[model samples]
Target: MSNDHRRLGRELDLFDSDPLVGAGLPLWLPGGAAARHEVESYLYELERRAGYQHVYSPALGKRRMYEMSGHWHNFADDMFPPMRIGDDELVLRPSMCPHHALIFKARGRSYRDLPLRIAELGQMYRAERSGVLGGLSRVRSIALNDAHIFCPEDQASAEVAGVLRLMREAHEALGMGEVSYQLSLRGPGGKYGGDDASWVRSEELLRGALSKAKISYADARGEAAFYGPKIDVLVADPAGRSWAMSTIQIDYHQPERFNLEFAGADGRRHRPVMVHRSLAGSMERLFGHLIEVHAGAFPVWYSPVQLAVLPVGADQDDAASSFAADALAAGLRAESVHDGSIGARIRDAAGRKIPYIGMIGSREAPDGLVALRLRDGRQLDPMPQAEAIALIASIAAARSQELLP
Candidate 1:
């Protein structure tokens, strides 16, 4: 088995640690940035299609927000120390729920907005212990694919089901098929925010939703959040280790604590139920998991450099440049490396685990053909550039790792 940290980042030139910036933070190298952008774009597109209105909130907030959300009491230990801005204390946001609640409060809500889904690709900060920091998994600063749905109590089940469907769709799109779900509940004597009846009712609703969906899940009795029970999606690595990647949670207490209310059809004020779900719990953790799961061999869609064009010599530079430009314009990520022999160039591309490698030498240049080498060690005879580009694009859009014929 491979040591978890040895697979990617450095090997693929994705990212590295900077002592000057402190531990638990990552400086994304060019390759790593590209991979992150691809994942972010995927999430943005998915959420957009699911009717979520994307928004951005500040990374830091007044201390009163956390106190109102009860995070100050329960999660203070994981929070960074507050900064003194005059008499007010400003703390880095460890989570975006409180901010989102403020947004709902700012706009007078009604039953007409019952199922409002707000999303953000939020950057969050947490104070993780130094020892637990490794690559991108346990980072201090991370991006979260976070969304919250505010619905009437009666609409709770449907909203939870909707979030689950979105999560499943995202996982399938990303080629993560072996994911498992866990329903985490509050333990005895846990410092939860709501009453016994409230907790029980919300838990039942969540359970029913998961059951109706026919999703296989495990139950964790003592692992719930202070304010709610949650359904966590766990993705296993190639080495058989499970990582928590997505979460769907029900919060009945926060709206009450924040005094969040909406007018019902009966013309009565009632508290709205809140569902906090993250398809990718945090980009940092997801990237780290992807590195281990793929063993640095990212699929075509997520690979930093999908293809590399290697010309035999300086004389072939023009052809290599032309090929790289054509591929780039066609929405295929490609680069040209013309300083090395054909064999060395191929080895370099292989080392990077690039999905495709094209060799342009004198023999193939005249006929407008390029020899294609796939990651799985298969070679195709000289093929037209358009066919190769189309083939690569199809593989990327479908997120297929297998080589094209």
Candidate 2:
């Protein structure tokens, strides 16, 4: 059987939840938060480089907006009840695209600004059933890697393709191998919000984009959102269980309902197509998946504490502390321990799966050198402190999983 994330999460001290905090809500500890920060930073930089304008959208919105977006009618059961205060029914937003659509509607646009991509690490809430609540995988409060692209009808395919490329590259960088795609389309009847013509156009555009990208995808009928069709990326765990990781959805109904318009070359107002994409479906769930996939042996770049310094005795404490301080200053996650026996400290560090460990004793502490220990049970005797720091820092900077020489 594969490792369970809940068990590994406790052992690694990554995250936890209390009954007082309500079910399905997790509080990230410092170490866990550090790892999550790296993930978020990586995604943020990638999206920024790809011309995504990051924004902060409010977590709460008026019920009137969801009503207009048709989420109230289509997804009300999964949504939190509206909070009525001062004659305003405020709702914890279950999705961010509706708010993103409103943002586009707030400003008039010309053809020059057609493919405006607005991205956010948006906060969303859902009313999950108590019986199903467990770890981060099934959370009520979620941080989503959400983005919406408002583009012209002709540019929709290109936009969807761009998002697909982002998803593929991100998975590759994270070593999430062999992802499968599913193109979700509407079924029959009035369950779908948009007209048949609009749905067909959006579905065809997504299909063409996948075809142009040379990606094979299964057509999933009746799996689409009420507003539009979408493409879902599925990744398998070590045990071969598949989990949905990313989604690229094209919405025609919301754009129309919001009266979102852009001026075209013909000098007339036309509705802009909206594409909603989430590269890391949800932060909490992705982290949970990563915990199980990597089995708490995160790559150097993702490890909360990459190096642990263990001193042989109290006499060598200064050297160990100095080395650790220097490593931390060099932007490496490093820590020093002198409270227990050298063997005990190393054992603890190894148990935590720290990538590297430094052993300082009487002989090496005097010469400002330390013995290096690899997580794989290899060791180097009496290397210069500066050399070890530089090598480990370099490997970490490169984001490689390889052990240092």
Candidate 3:
């Protein structure tokens, strides 16, 4: 592998794994944690605005839960071994949908609660062969921005349309506005659940939803989940590589198996249509794509350090510190480096893709001005500290990948 590809996670200080912990698990470093937090926060806000009620569930559940959800039959090979807890068997959750369904059952919902959207930043586990475990792209332990919507059968199309809207909004926020959609339908299968009618209706609803939204999508047969058909959103990277980042699936079998029902307007018990949607399919995969897409040069809004202040010499330390403080106060990520030469400092900042660099010296400090250098080394005329701070903050807010000059 080239240095650019191999050293991304290391250079960005995102994650690393060790043999002592076995394979497929990563130890996230501080920088990686910050990036994860920023993305999670963004998703939380977006989901909240869409009226999703956030929930949490345990990492392990009774094996019977998987059996009831039909994951044990079709997906058991990817799941970890069951644990013997006295008379009961437990296994780590491979997906959050089963647990979320239990929550709906716990409360016994009604038609008044139709279109109930519940979301969770769920940490899931799976057993993957060592060969497939790579950086963050493929891992054993993954976090999913998972959500489930329980809408009446008649309202399934509209609820799915809302999920598509949310998915598009998320992609645009992450600077992936060119994302495309794929409609993955079931093929003549042996492992998949449900009969012909179930698959047919689910596919029609998904197709109708996409058409009503006026979004263009491609169809792919035999790519659907064992229990449902789905629509996946694929994002194009800077290198023109495509990554499947999100999915919205319609499940007609699970609700019936779980005996989940809600009272309709006729005071009759009805099976609620279930939609499983994830804007960020798996945090691990998303992070891996991000590293490659930006080439480790994250946009200011996502950068751990958006700006770096480089002092010309030790004598300019105080001025550099002042500039850094101002930048931080204005909600711009900033750092100061006074131990290195001006050239070394510039090179370091450039290597890390820091969006803005401020140089402090006797000439600029005494006049309350700083020499601004962008990531590309283009020098901007010396400007007052406030203007520089404002410029950096604006760029960060706008999520501009290129530095302001």
How are the candidates ranked when ordered by TM-score, highest leading? 1, 2, 3
Give per-candidate clash totals: 0, 0, 0
lDDT per residue for candidate 1 within 357-397, as digits (tens), equals 98888888877778888998998988987788888999898
User: What's the lDDT for residue 70 in model 2?
Assistant: 93
CA lDDT of every candidate: 0.87, 0.88, 0.84
User: Could you tell me the lDDT of residue 69 within candidate 1?
Assistant: 96
- Model 3 Cα lDDT, one tens digit per residue, 325-346: 8888887778899876789878
Per-prediction TM-score to the true structure, in the order listed:
0.96, 0.96, 0.93
In model 3, which regions exceed 4 Å deviation?
Answer: 1-5, 235-242
Top lDDT: which candidate number? 2
Order candidates by lDDT, high to low: 2, 1, 3
Model 3: pairs clashing at backbone N, Cα or C within 3 Å: none
